[model samples]
Target: MAARPVSGAGAIRVGIGGWTFEPWRGTFYPDKWPHKRELEYASRQLTAIEVNGTYYSGFKPETFAGWAKVAPDDFVFALKASRFCTNRKVLADAGESIARFTGQGIVELGDKLGPILWQFMATKKFDAVDFAAFLKLLPASQDGVRLRHAVQVRHESFAVPEFVALCRDAGVAIVYAQSDDYPAIADISGDLVYARLETAVEDEPAGYSPVELDRWADAARVWAAGGQPDGLASVSDPAPVMPRDTFVFMISGAKVRNPAAAQALIARL
Candidate 1:
């Protein structure tokens, strides 16, 4: 629950989910303006954050670098691949876009780019054949690339052994989400974990709820205490999972109320 860097022998493996703005609003001023102050605040405790805005366009490299400069050498940043890539399922074109993000956006952030998250929508179901084909298309397979690769699926239909095997075989970390599709949590297990919180109740999807963020933060803590080579059952079991070193990303900013979501999770921590 402490806002500190969660490190292991390999990657720094920390949360890149930065959805809040106020706490960092003044932190990063007119000087570094949004860059230095932002990173300085983030690096104060949290190790990494998900680049939520990159999914949209108009990203600049210099800004990323300013953030990298502020953060310490060991600090890490998880860069989310654009929606054109993950949401649209344009794996082929996604490669080029991803390359651009890495070469441009990431380079600016420098060494802070910790992992590359390929998050998909819940409306998208799992087509094992299509997905398997898509996974094979990543320009550089998980092994070939230096960055960690993780996938988040919204539909429970995708929670099949074949899919899990495919992700495991591909070295992709499958997400264990806390939405209505909540799949036993035992079903999804891998080296890395990406967790998102959506807490907007004023108005939202048919059954959307923002209050769940509190429960999730508690659950994330339980799941983030272990490392890899850790079997599915072991990671799923609450016994070991309770106090494991697993890295559950604190992703937010899915909407305007994301600030509310971030505050909720941060409060729990």
Candidate 2:
């Protein structure tokens, strides 16, 4: 987030959910800047972004390629898996939907591609057998690129050892979504860590309070170094010293100022 160099393979990426919000034009971007150049501009400012468009609607291969061409080499874009795949009534029945979504040209992003987020609705209670079957559906690669998956389960039923073990065994990270509306499970289930901070307020200049941003930065560093933060809710016990790359996103809540919040957190890192 702060443009800091990552030693070895471990890195810390800080960013917002998306780059096309109109409210960011005057605040996060130049008021007179062309809308078409928003991605290019935002890529320069934030280390990463969670591409939310793919969740609502699919994009063409050329569209993904176009995005890759505009951003910096180090910039990463985490794609949110299609809602059609995760919003279904039967989690185990998502194979075809999942395959269709993954086959929809996401590999065109190449090196710019980060983790793919699979967010389930809050009402989708955790069913160990069904959830395990769904986890098995996630592929490890697309074309020649290795794929990373992060699951954001909103139901309170997901806070359990069985859920954590399923994710850990599958090597899928469990998204550490920070907000009052969702269950807070900060378990480190895979090789990478993902966090979505949604507490940014409208009036707060940087979205979150300065102290809060500082705390987030601290926690991010710990995760990047392959350690979990103390005091946060966690379901798994990560090895005491194994380090991993981490991604932290400032999303939702005070959406208008999310970019600013990311920049603020980046500054601390």
Estimate the TM-score for candidate 1: 0.64
lDDT of 2 by residue, 1-269 (tens): 33444465368899998898888989999989999999989999999999998899988999999999999888899999999999988899999989888888989989899999999998899999999999999999988789999999999999988899999899999999999797899988889889999888999999989888889888988888777788798766664456677899999999998999998888887
Please state the error at residue 213 of candidate 2 in Å: 0.9
Most accurate candidate by TM-score = 2
Candidate 2: give the clashing pairs. Answer: 1-266, 226-243
Model 1, range 131-167, lDDT digits (tens) per residue? 8766665544232335667777777677567777777
Total backbone collisions, model 1? 18
Best prediction by lDDT: 2
Clashes of 2: 2
